[model samples]
Target: MSVQALVRWVAAGLAALVVSAMPMAASAQQPSKSSMALANEILDIKGSLQIFETVIPGVVEKSKATLLQMNPNLFKDVDAIGNDLRKEFAPRLAVLREEIAKIYATRFTEQEMKDTIAFYKSPLGKKILTEEPNFVDRSMAAAQDWAVKLNDEVLQRFRAELRKRGHPF
Candidate 1:
């Protein structure tokens, strides 16, 4: 496989591994009828428990960039590779969304799930629902930058303390 194809394949495998690691309290057995119904309802209202529509594409694009950076010569047809990656991941997304909905059902009571669905269905709630992914993406990016700086300072302080204790690097 080309570098782009190889990276996408690895990423898809990792996503499966991460999803498999989701808590299986409810998944350990068949879901109750009401729970299954509620899970379906929740999926209908929210589409997914987590934002994959934008996020997955973003990651794939980033991976494409990284792959090109590492070996630009290997993928002469970037668009074809991108389309292939999307096609590969598209089928798996539905299964992923259903799995996430089931996980949400296990974590929340039926009533709570209904309440959430209702909130998302409301007008202002609809606006929030539409804007939330973008808001979260920006907030998370800022947080990651902040965390990196904080981590560096914290690590330096701890290392200094260790050196003060007569430890050598």
Candidate 2:
């Protein structure tokens, strides 16, 4: 796959993980400060926050592309400004981190967060963490290939039915 396609797939997978982790309902009670702290620790141990590292840069590049499309001659200026904006907006990632932690804090209790952190620090958890990317990659590829075969089967069946009906298909 192309680098861009890989990046998009990874981004989408991470996004789906985040969405799945969220609480189903809004909580009337806010998470305690200690629970939030535990949630942050869980995030750190899981390295979930690393996904946010590209947010600022991606936004900057997208905006630069939009501007460059209108004024192609301003490439130099747009590039410089994009770099500056990346640095300027970098701190906004903290806000996203906090919001995600809040979601975790709301979904899981403080004890659960502590358990999660402990698991992540354990040997089995470490092994899973090391191997999960490869597992997910192979699983997704297998699923995609299976889907393609199933689609071809369905199309062939449809063509057979159409031919039976005197249609060219």
Which residue ranges in model 2 land beyond 4 Å of their true spot?
1-18, 21-25
Candidate 1 local Cα displacement, residue 1, angstroms: 30
Candidate 2, 89-113: lDDT as tens digits: 9899899788777888888888888
Candidate with the greatest lDDT versus the true structure: 2
Would you estimate the TM-scores of all the predictions?
A: 0.54, 0.84
Query: Candidate 1 clashing pairs?
Result: none
All models: lDDT?
Answer: 0.69, 0.80
Give the deviation of candidate 1 from the true structure as CA RMSD. Answer: 7.4
Candidate 2, 61: how far from true, in Å? 1.5
